[model samples]
Target: MIMNPIPTQSSEIRVTPIPRMTQGGRWRVEAMRSYTSDLLLWFTRGQGRITVSGRTRGFGAHNAVFIPAGTMHGFEITSQVFGTAAFFPRSLNLAFPQEPLHLRIRDAAPQGDLTLILENLQRELDGDRPKKERAAENYAGLFSVWLDRAKLQYPQNERKSEKADQLVARYSTMIEEQFRSGRTVSEYAQALGITPTHLSRICNKSCGRSASALLADRILYEARRLLRETKLPVQQVAAQLGFTSAAYFSRAFQNHTGKTPSDFRRGA
Candidate 1:
């Protein structure tokens, strides 16, 4: 029998304070298609296959990976799977533990550590303390340690940042770098040597959203990241983002996230 789906909220999706992915023998995960908030994904046990954002990752006795923000990724587990996943952002600018290291273990190795992480996650899941707000902190500690070991197991291979095979690549790159400047679309068009009318037409044809919508999204992404990761006063965040005052920042944040800056920072 099919169970009715649950209701969802507009402000990015977040699951329970802590979610566990565990299953016994012979279970498979179907492809999950949905938009998740900043961070989410934890696998702790068993074995399975995950196809996310076009990359296929295997979750085994000790397989784990993080799906970056706005990355359209998910999994199709071909076997039993278990683990813990967290949806987080850049709030923790980890000092040493997050040095973009590769895991030392091969994909075929036994997943002993994966099991331990799962157990610790279970502990947190059953805890009564306020876990939702502290979730990023916990993941920082875990990721640092795991990434260290994983670094030894897997080394990263950074690809050169080249323009994509599309007309919008150059424009998209510029928008990402200057979205915080709060310039109008015409301003961006001038920098790209394109007219405002052509810019709007191309952007709309390539991206579903309008030029204004995409610019706002880029700005909001950074805003949310800064708000969550740092203890910088809200006023400072506003100034850094070119807002004249905290009040203005609050208004923009509310318009996008539907929560006041202070309220969002308070972990509500």
Candidate 2:
């Protein structure tokens, strides 16, 4: 279920249960997408795999995943997972990590501290109080502090970096920067000084997906978002995303999402 939304004219912060966010469709939650606001997901129960910046890792209880704005990421959640997704607008200018972090909290004290902060944040938003926006901001600031302290308390273990991991990481970064350019996988592989087959091979090994599939997922997620959230015409949307023709955009979108742009927008 959704908690009360707290939003200012210029920014927004909302707390919602993890399972509720995926009530639409699996693709809505599993498809690779980025946001203009930073996202922190706190899982208190269950286990699943999440992919951040081309690296997939298993996550379980008390695992906190922080994704910076504009990072391509996605996660698979099971029915038993219990979590809160706190969205902090990057415009707030709070102290947030520049990179994605996966922190598995092993201690109960810190875990309780995070849960308390989130509870307060949700309460403030749900209550009918004066200056609620300011109170939400204050809680958001406290949440960031909690995150910093938790990071120090539960430092991530370093893993040996394989060549494939490094390569896929670089490719993921490039996709984040240029996904809207409508560049093909071959073109991207060429820019990285590798053949398309080599790039796809490494990507599959790194994330269990092909390079082309990864690129298309990122592109289609943006397309879906724009269609649902904006009033742009179909042709304009296609052009903005660098598609040569509206028909081509329509075909690609349908192939990926099983819905035409207009139909998706109408239903949305």
Candidate 3:
């Protein structure tokens, strides 16, 4: 599950065409992995199933899938597929769906508009036109608008409480800023003016996972990324992740990922 960093044509965004298949038709066997950037995949002609953060769903033509940064995901294409993939940093500040999304573009106008945006985005990346970066950003903004419309159209059941949602979002943002500091869940809860138990309950209700689990997931993802993408040793990676000892870090990583840090690095 070692994913190489995606190359970008622009510093802010990347648009790449997805091939129908690899030369040997063996792209399906790649292990599940994740990215440090947000991903939006548009399938114009395809049949496939995608797994995101342990949930699997089927998709077909005219579907757009979103995988937020650091979420583990993979795909299997059953038939010939053609698509465009957009990768952008989370700092772009687009209010995309918080969770993974599989949006179907059924209506003709929206689908055609989406296709045109993708085409122009590709052209902006490929051609040496003036102010191409700004052009790409504008197209990316339009694409985000399209996705927001799709999310609005998608039906929902009972929604989580607004208060709970706000708490979870704030907590998540704090984690991103402070995960490297070895802060405890209780400390984070105290900073947010809530008890640790209440924070856990809110996280569970909002995302079906505990607050501690979310914190540990972020730490482990960073560990894996460091192990795979850098030459840092296991001990160094452990220390960088705020572990007290290399041995403790190894045990924690094994418990969460079923692989020792050294083994995982070697495999990668």
**Best prediction by TM-score:** 2
Q: Which residue segments of model 3 deviate by more than 4 Å?
A: 1-3, 7-12, 16-84, 89-104, 123-138, 141-161
Comparing 1 and 3 by lDDT, which wins? Answer: 3
Best model per lDDT: 2
Candidate 2 regions exceeding 4 Å error are 1-10
Write the candidate numbers in order of decreasing lDDT. 2, 3, 1
Q: Across residues 82-157, which tens digit of lDDT does each residue of candidate 1 receive?
A: 4445544444554333211212245543356544554565556456768543653564567557655666656555
Question: Which whole-number lDDT from 0 to 100 does residue 35 have in model 1?
Answer: 29
Better of 1 and 2 by TM-score: 2
TM-score to true structure, per model: 0.41, 0.89, 0.66
* lDDT (0 to 1) per candidate: 0.51, 0.85, 0.74
Q: What is the lDDT of residue 132 in candidate 3?
A: 93
Per-residue lDDT of 183-216 in model 3, one digit per residue for the tens?
9999999999999999999878665668898788
Candidate 3 clashing pairs?
Answer: none
